[model samples]
Target chain A: MNCFKALLLLLLCTSLPAVEPVKLTDDGRMKFTPVFVDGDTRLTFVDFENPKVFRLKSMDWKTREVKVVHEAAPAPEFDPAYSIDGNYFSFLRTTGGLQVSLVIRNRKSNEEVVIAPEPGFSGYRTPAIAPDSSQMLFSFANNFGQDIFRIDMKGEGRTALTGTKGINIWPSYSPDGKKIVFTSTRDGNYELYEMKPDGSEIKRLTDSPYQDIRGQYSPDGKQIAFVSHRDGNAEIYLCNADGTSVRRVTNHEERDDYPTWHPDGNHLVYVAERDGSHDLYLLPLKD
Target chain B: MLNIGSFKTKTCSGIGRRSFLQMSGAIPFGLGMSGLGMVTADEVDHVVAKAKSIVFVFLWGAPSHLDTCDPKPNSNSDYRGPFGVIPTRTPGVHFTELLPKLAQRSDKYTLIRSHIQSAPGHPDGGTVALSGFEENPKPVKPNFGSIIARHRGFRGKLPPFFSIANGVVMDGGRRIEAYGGGEMGAVYDPFMVGASETGKVNIPALALMDDVNPLRITDRRQLLQQLDSVPRTLEKSKFRDWNRTYQQAYGLITDPTARQAFDLTQESVKTRQRYGQSVFGQSALLARRLVEAEVPYIQLNYSRHVEAITPGYEFGWDTHLYNFSLLQDQHCPIFDRAFSAFLDDIYARGLIDDTLIVCMGEFGRTPKINVRAARDHWPQCYFSMWAGAGLQTGRVIGESDKNGEHPITRPITPLMVGTTIAELAGVDSQARAEMRVLDGGRVINELL
Candidate 1:
């Protein structure tokens, strides 16, 4: 999708002229879990699990219907981070031990490249593809705390960006690909931190005694909308890239968390606890 | 200011790091309480004689000297770019049109047209500028402001030092290092105030009413706390220190005076309009009010974030290819107007005489335009303008080459500038400068 189109949809959320949203498509599959394939047009996410059959169903926004984007993707996995061009989709694959497999299926030739040729990495899951899709960032454990590491897609080298002794997870990159914003349990609570992709000049974006986790930048990187518990509940908070203008977006009695903005930013998918059941909900942003 | 009416209050915020304020026998800001109960009324009412407040306008990114500070009229177009040079009041001195207002009021301040730092990167430049030390080979250093808050405390309940407009994280890897006290501790850190969606200065901590019955609540909570403690008094111990800070913090949760300082309502609509309604300008106005509240220092980060971040909002002064357009079309317009308004307003309000305003970035923009027509970081040469307080002013103390590439005259060090600030604060220049990472460096003697 065009950055403008996606953000135009997202722009309905933030009318500020400076921050145009990265556009995502409005396919009519009751589209909820939006994992970008590329642009605002292509999107795929888990949808419609037949309770009788108990099987995962997939939907593609580009086609605007419940189509077979992929057949047998597993459970405990969602939100596939597509490549910048969105020709491929990579999600965490659980096979024996938890491993992240990049199921790179070229739409043009209908060819696929699975990075995980075999089973491994009980820890490596929730893979985040870089914009260029040349590398992947995810969480892992070692002597240091549960930190996020980036591995080259071509299997060249795996580099750990957040080597803090505290837990640093939910590694997400800005649309510009200059900085990385992640959540860290440093200072005795989860706060937000942004740093260069090379892990230099790290800056703290949030300062709270409460848990401030699951932060992601809008497609334009002008604003970061994250889920924070600063307001006595897990609410969606929006702030500028500089960590200013922080405002809460969600204010429901239900538990609202896991917010992923649409490529256009006009909408976001959240895991809200309504009716005593945790289910995926699409919040149609005003934008 | 007298001890007679000064009964101590309780804790403030329980948030980790610096929100834990410790107020006890130790007069906060470390002002020694030597003659306990002996201070007369005259001493209490006496106006604070020290004109030691600080107004730090932290420009994001290194600004391009070739276009803004030092112009090269004779240099090639690619090098000189588009700006035409204009003469200033001082004979033989010139500035780019980017600083038209600053140029007119140049006499009120001193300009170091050619200061040098080694780091060409954002975090490095900020570290060097803030700490008065190179960013290399050291994990941390105390900033000059942090040192001031440590050695000399605030005059009122206001924070000893404060930062307006800055909530953006920069190069420093961990913690809130932008307005920091590296190892000297977080207590000396400046209280942050900026525009959030809620429009409050610092994030609103819980507060209490001034007329609220503190005695009843204290009696009730003190009784409750006593039931849990073995000692009868629950006083005068490390735990008591913790409890007192906790209690004052509790008082802060409800106090109106603490929140009123951040009230934009205090200023009339006309005043707010006079200072641009934009976040940056309003932030500067708030910074002045903070000064009025006796906050010693304030830093206003012009930019929002560290990167090009979104559109139209450049945080750091790192203008690359797109920078010139931003500087011309969007960036410089904000700076020239906001700064001129601040300088003029502060001076007109008579706060300028005591409040020292220092305006500069981590480094200078590249002398030459790059592939994108924007300048990258250049630490080799730069310029800064300082005014107010007792520090010497009206003279351009240093010089850069025709293109603003490198210093041609007095290439002062960051340490000298840091020492210069110490001198203006009435603190022992050499001693306080030593307190900063730029230890042992004497005040910049030439300008004085």
Candidate 2:
């Protein structure tokens, strides 16, 4: 029976004619699991059987576009995070086990460039650009678990902003671009914390026994929509920036988190796992 | 060369005198002190080739080609070893499934399966594998890389020769002649890099940043040379002093190009991920960069940090008694991905035309499985590899028997390989003067 299944799977695949050199441009959505949009130019980050890549295009009103540019080979890039400003984006690349530097992509000009750390540089990953898009923040693992780091926008190098001994991740700067809300394991379980861009202030946003992470600030900088597993299963929760006004927006015993603000505070979108798979879902704000 | 921070053992005068004393002893006491051991030094000469550089990817801990490469699926499962082979771009040739990337580019390399060597132990295997000479009863010989290094130092600013991992490249202590510069001065020893246990390691002497301003490092070097006292590890042998002189050459650590060779960050994220997040993968990429910087020889060591040795290798590849059981689950995965990506990049970037890549273990495993369901060491016959550097590419050089034991076609020896390295390094092994180290050691001529 297993052999039959294997044979059928093989047949279905081989039954197709030889694959042509696919110069893909139109299949932008599926090209990346989470296709990132930037104006008329619809962009997608694809992870092939090989390396991950970010592909950019200038789409028509019909979304028809030409392949404007691509990063070098090993193929489709992964984990690309862009700044609030469309001018710059960053992604992680690995080819042949050597993890070198972070990448900053500019859509205005179709050029993919790397702000690579020199050989022997340590503890760096997942660079996120600030809203103003001048400075970037990322994580670094040392004898301590992981810390947050901010580097010059010009990519001169890196500077440690949060010099603590814990795993600090998803450091998102507020719309005002002054405060950074990130998740950390320092308070034991994962929880949200807000601090000045210099990493001075300390305000806890959520208290949970389970993991609550990927904290993002609202356009008004008053609230944070974050993912949590406080009530048995994973779900999204909203709370005041000062750890007040705790509210459970959606409850179905499913993981509904990774929420992003839509420039307007009235609507927020997030990833949801209803049955078993995770896809994007939106919820209207009560405000 | 500044063996500082180099770990060493307490002296108890175990066997031979300290290398330094040995050097002093080389002088006839009654005849008045002479120079460092000059046992009739000759300018080893040989035909030179345009292939001045070689990038040797030494697969350490002796990877099993039967299961990982040179697969014979048709034979009985026991004799076939294990891991099934896959189709490669090179027709009639197939690699194990672990190496999907390399399988597609098999035509880019030349595989020599029927390598016959005498050493079954690690050091012996390594010696025969690198120097292309058997550990003889008398004076030992230098490794092929060291031999070239002695010819002039690296053709570039970086250490002329460097080793990443052990592979067959190291001497199994009992036979230092294999990897170490035996009779030749220590100046020929390959400079080993990336010794730090943490993946976040500093190249010790090389600068990686484009804005490093180069001069800052030179200013530091001058201070260290003038202000600080550089102490040498006390060994009595002339080779020990030679090693000291070799360390002095590292003073060129001032060269920007040399440091840039070790700068992995300069390569893109896409390139790093393609290689996978493993030591062997990173090492292979660094090797490519070093070669691009014109370092003649580089060895990329598969790490043995003990943090992830067998199961994920953390970079260990010894698969003797636990060959099948451990390899499929642990070893081959990283090797397959990294090796494939490395070869792919080399060809994609057109680096293949200029670089000579030899990827092989010291010796093949026993054809028959042991009681433990693993293959033991069988140095009687094994495989070596050859590609690039003007030699013909795209095909296996020799064939093995049904049991994957002996060679059925053209047999290979150490001399041919030594001769080949000499040809690449522009040395003439056949030249009468070059034969000095051998006092006559065997030189593999066929490899050329």
Model 2 misses residue A175 by how many Å? 51
The Cα error of candidate 1 at residue B181, in Å, is 1.0
lDDT of 2 by residue, B387-443 (tens): 777665665665666677665544455555666666665665444255464334433
**Candidate number of the best lDDT:** 1
* Tens digits of per-residue lDDT for model 2, A41-135: 44333322211123332223233443434444443244456766678867755432223356766767857667654343232445667878878
Task: Estimate TM-scores for all models.
Answer: 0.50, 0.51
**Per-candidate TM-score, first chain only?**
0.74, 0.72
lDDT per residue as tens, model 1, B296-332: 7677777553222122333345554335434643456
- Candidate 1 lDDT over A20-114, as tens digits, reads 22222222111123454556554456432321011223445555444554456443334466667765555644332223344444455766555
Comparing to the true complex, what docking class would candidate 2 get?
A: incorrect
In candidate 2, position B2 carries an lDDT of 14
What clash count goes with each model? 51, 51
> DockQ, per-model, please?
0.02, 0.01
